[model samples]
Target: MKMMKNFRNEDGFSLIELLFSITVLSVGLLGIASTIPFGYKAIEQSAKRSTAASLLNEGLEKLKGYQYINLIESNFPDEVYGDIPDFPDFARTYEIRMASDVYSSPIPELKMVTITVFWRVSATNEQRIFAVTYIGQRR
Candidate 1:
């Protein structure tokens, strides 16, 4: 009968149980908070890669617009891309060189075009993306 009376009186959690629950909740919240920085970094890197790919495609399209005679006779100039309002951190360049043995015979009628995009991923590390394509005399 005395034990029943004590049990009835203790309808809520003890102080130790309440403190333990609070500590557990705090640790779980902290663990979730720790991942936010890594998620943000991943998102940033993805955006940079997307921008680099777009630049590469644009450079190739401009080169492809030239006619076969003009494209064959001319040399691709080295370009230093800088100071775009949209992509402030990026640097881009491109080059064209004669390719060998594209046909069965050694006429040297083919050309290899390469586009390179670079950026600083961090204070000391650099990141780059390159695209290469072959251009033959237009039919």
Candidate 2:
């Protein structure tokens, strides 16, 4: 009982301490917020790239349905400034050429096919992705 009479207790934070904590918290929040725009931009670019890759695959699949002899440069359709029906922001094209033109030695039985997808990120920024494959005549 004698010790209790001399005890003084201080609990909870002072105003100055509270203010300092709040300032630190606010700075942390602002630092996290600043990166949000860059994250969004990266997500957008990834989505666009995915779309372009899908278009390239679509072109290749279409080619697979044709006869080997029909895989000629003139046989495949090429689009210029042509927007896909579902993806108007993107345009696609493909080229077919003799494989012999690419290889050092003649390979008359093979044809080289290239598919390209194009889009614009900004008025001054244009982007494209392409894939190549070779089709050979069956023995």
**lDDT (tens digit, per residue) of candidate 2 on 55-116:** 88999999989998788767766665554777878888878888888786466778888899
Q: Give the runs in model 1 whose Cα sits over 4 Å from its true position.
A: 1-11, 69-85, 101-107
TM of each candidate vs. truth: 0.79, 0.84
Which digits, one per residue and each the tens of the lDDT, describe model 1 over residues 1-139?
9999999898799889999999999999999999999999999999999998887787788876787566643455544435544777777776666777333536467777678988779988879899988778856
Question: Which portions of model 2 miss their true places by more than 4 Å?
Answer: 1-9
Q: Model 1, residue 71: displacement in angstroms?
A: 4.2
User: CA lDDT of 105 in candidate 1?
Assistant: 38
Error of 2 at 73 (Å): 3.1
Q: List the residue pairs that clash in candidate 2.
A: none
Candidate 1: C-alpha RMSD after superposition: 3.6
- Candidate 1: minimum summed lDDT over ten consecutive residues — where? 72-81
